[model samples]
Target chain A: MRKAIAASAAVIMLSIGAIAGAAEVKMVGTVQKIEMQGGAATVTLKDTKSGNEVKVTVKDDLTLDKFKDKRIVDGDEVRVKYDDGDGVVTIFRKTAGC
Target chain B: MTKILFTGLVAGAVMASAAFAKDHPGREYMEKNGYKGPETCEVCHPGKAKEFLSTVHWTHASKVDNVENTDPAREYGMKNRIYTMCNGNDIVNNLKEIPKTPDAKGTKFSGCNTCHPGNHLSDVGSAGPEAEAAIDCLVCHSREYDHSKRKPFKDDQGRVVLGQDRSVKAALAIAKPTVKNCMTCHEAAGGGVLVKRGFAFTKENDVHAAKGMVCVDCHKAKNHKIPTGFDPNNWAHDGVRVACADCHTETPHKDAEYNRHTARIACQTCHVTRTGGSFAKDFTTWEKLSNGYYEPTTLRKDANETVPVYAWYDKTVANRPDFIGPKGSRSDKASRIYPFKVFQGKGFFDRKTGELLAMDFAPPMSNGDTLAGVASAAKILGIKQYDPVPGWQTVLFGSNHLVTKKNALTCNNCHAPNGVLRFKDLGYSDDEVKRLTSPELYLQKMAEKQREEW
Candidate 1:
């Protein structure tokens, strides 16, 4: 229950952080874990370069459907651009496809 | 031609926006400056340029990592490792510096590095912005990149020079590399265009290419270092290796019988059914002609259909220069039945040292001195001067590409009597061969292994 609260707080920060930090950082990372709730989803990504787990919230409808359909599954390497301050991914897509 | 280049330019300009090309944030800056040099790209991507500067693609040599050379002293590429193609006498030794363009005579440019992406070969272990500035970024990033324009020649000043196409259009076209980008250099491998390595991974040859999969789909390059699996003879690099298991898991087949074969057989062994080349340059022998002109006698053995020689191989087979192949036995679990392209050429070899002497006979004769280059290489190898005997150098090239599921080998293809596979030569006993040829026995073994696992 405590873990769920932390995750919920993270999603709120993503919404508020979008306006705080506009400078998006692009990086390639492997998907470690995914947690979905209502219209919001949090993806745990292990950075390819630093090997650090970064929790980023995804609000995009297309990307959310990709997760639901298993098209973007765990262990998939994704090239993402996210707001470092809020932890919301602007661009999230698999690195393996054409 | 002008219209097409203009159309490509206009389209590329639209895509060059910072949002469109996230990787090339400075794409517009490069275009505005007419893509002056590798330095301009550093204005936005200093980190990317810095990461790529010291790579083998740029420096042509790096500290011994995956080289697997027998000589402990073979610590770097090109500088060490006596190459089978040119015997450490190609552009790696000849090219001293980069000039602006290929001279009128086109004498300064040599082979090997000709296929290399870099406009000039940087110093080994070199880093920093100065080295990064010398790198030609468009060659690997732009689909419109034309390698023919980047020619090397000797200027009247007697300095080696290179001609480059650094247009704003080319800069704007820059994006993440595609098959077209990699193939611009990789396609011209071996000898002139459409030779050995070039034949593989084409739209018609490989299934991946047919489905529009690029080299990176399998190669999986990070930063600048691409994973090369236990590089072939003369290929010196120390890095992670790409394996079939990376994509196809250890157990790829539905049936246990086929999956069991993966333990002893390579993915390419059955998939790469034949090697191709319309007029492939085969066995070449050099003759010191009576008129002091050296003549080369080349026999094109296989026109287009060439079967690869299956041999027991592991990653470390290329360290031994005398034996340029995968070194492993059938008994070794690390080894598998891998396909190979055997190269036979007449060259000088030392009988006492068993050192495959550098074949001075040149392709377009880079140095023009037949024995002079050989003698210098011999000195470096610490080979005592003696009567140089005429010897045949058998070099083996790995056949891992040009794959097709359609033409994959069936059981009868190798198991039938007088079959393509020579089981005895491959260290198989007569009884073992008989058992291997029997499909029932192979299935039984697979079932037994699966049962044991359960």
Candidate 2:
């Protein structure tokens, strides 16, 4: 009984760590390019704050609804959210008025 | 003893009369000149004066809660306070609570009596019924108020001294307001005729004016709350109270396809092809003078013939952002394709920060300047050093005038190969244009196959 309780506590701690490790990363940047291929899009973004360029991959099925009837394009100032663990972009939105 | 008493009474009477004249100088002057003041007009049009006070023309700037406050100049702490050229001396003095610091001399214009007839002289406070009599009712009501005679003289403090000859003429000629009366100040706004916006009110090239529809017809003011059609987020909030659908309903076009296009295309996209012609120049370059005024160096090479740039706009947003680089896709529901008069100019941007500077630097004291009037703006904005960016900034304003339906673009104008509409830039796939343009070929092939089967 003592051994089972210790094992359960260990599993819970591991789950918490896994969840924390996969925290979402948000960045504001201008899109430099979007290369679409095989139901996925690879977007190159130039960070507005840091001025550094980063390439992010977005899967086709990963609900890009924030772009809502619009596709990601070059020269678009967008705010993007991505899962840091997998390094995959999940959401994109225009950051002009907002 | 009788002579002394009589002399004392005469002196006292003179002193009392002098005090009365000093207190009500504006009223005394109007009474002597045989001019009935605003008080007389107010007795008949009582609600007008109260209603006019609520309008942007009377107030100049929108209230703090209004969308105008969301401008980058205000949001980024560049413009500390909303200072308008329309406020009188009394209003300016009352606005001391709003924090503002101007570095340059003679930058701020004192009083708005030059344009606003209802406002009294800067010295004579518009207070009681006697003071309220100073409102010039004929400025808006009369077509005979000659603008050339309305010469404004300012004291050393820049306050407008009223009692000009035009004031009396304005009072006498109380007729209904006409298009000419409205154009006196509006046409000359931003230094010269049609200098502010390329499509601003000019006698020629204005589709509405050519159609015999005056400014008041579309921009009907009720209690002076003139609707400006500025609210982007809500069509209901568009101050102009009128919409294109009001005149041209949902089924304006006879063709089903053309009528269907209305769901995705703005009316001005087809109606207003180009602007800046006739009385106005196509392009104007403002050069700042040593006297701190901007003079336009106009380029009229393509006057009235320049093609308007196209963009997508979401009407629901107040203060729409410029040029989102065409619709991302044809399915973009938030935005409709719209036409714009593109104004290309060199504007200052911070080289270090890469942020566009939001300082007013231009002609027309009311409309804040951005780039050309930077020297004067630097003082007002409290910026010490100035470094201009290398490239030019292209600003786009919606062109809804100069409407010539005959000059409207057809489908081939945009869909053809090497057309003005950049399909790739509009976020269409590579083959989208080829597929859209050559539907006839596919139909021909299908017909040939059907004939072969027969």
Candidate 2 residue-wise lDDT, A1-87, digit = tens: 999999999999998998888988888788787776666777788876688888888774422321221323456566678887776
Docking class of 1: incorrect
Report the number of the highest-lDDT candidate: 1
Q: Best TM-score goes to which candidate?
A: 1
Q: Candidate 2: deviation at residue A76, Å? A: 47
Where does model 1 exceed 4 Å of error? Answer: A1-98, B1-27, B62-69, B76-79, B90-93, B96-108, B121-128, B155-157, B194-198, B277-304, B318-321, B359-369, B372-387, B439-454
Question: Where is the poorest 10-residue window by lDDT in model 1 chain B?
Answer: B98-107
lDDT of 1 by residue, A15-85 (tens): 77776757788887888898997797999988877878899999976477557635477766676888887
Across B248-345, the per-residue lDDT of candidate 1 in tens digits comes to 66776666667788999888887777765322221134432221223234332222257778888866655553556777789899988888776655
Candidate 2 regions with alpha-carbon error over 4 angstroms: A1-98, B1-37, B63-137, B156-158, B161-176, B200-204, B230-240, B277-303, B316-330, B350-378, B381-391, B418-420, B438-454
lDDT accuracy of residue B375 in candidate 1: 67
Against the true structure, candidate 2 has what lDDT?
A: 0.48
- Looking at candidate 2 chain B, the ten consecutive residues that score lowest on lDDT are B78-87
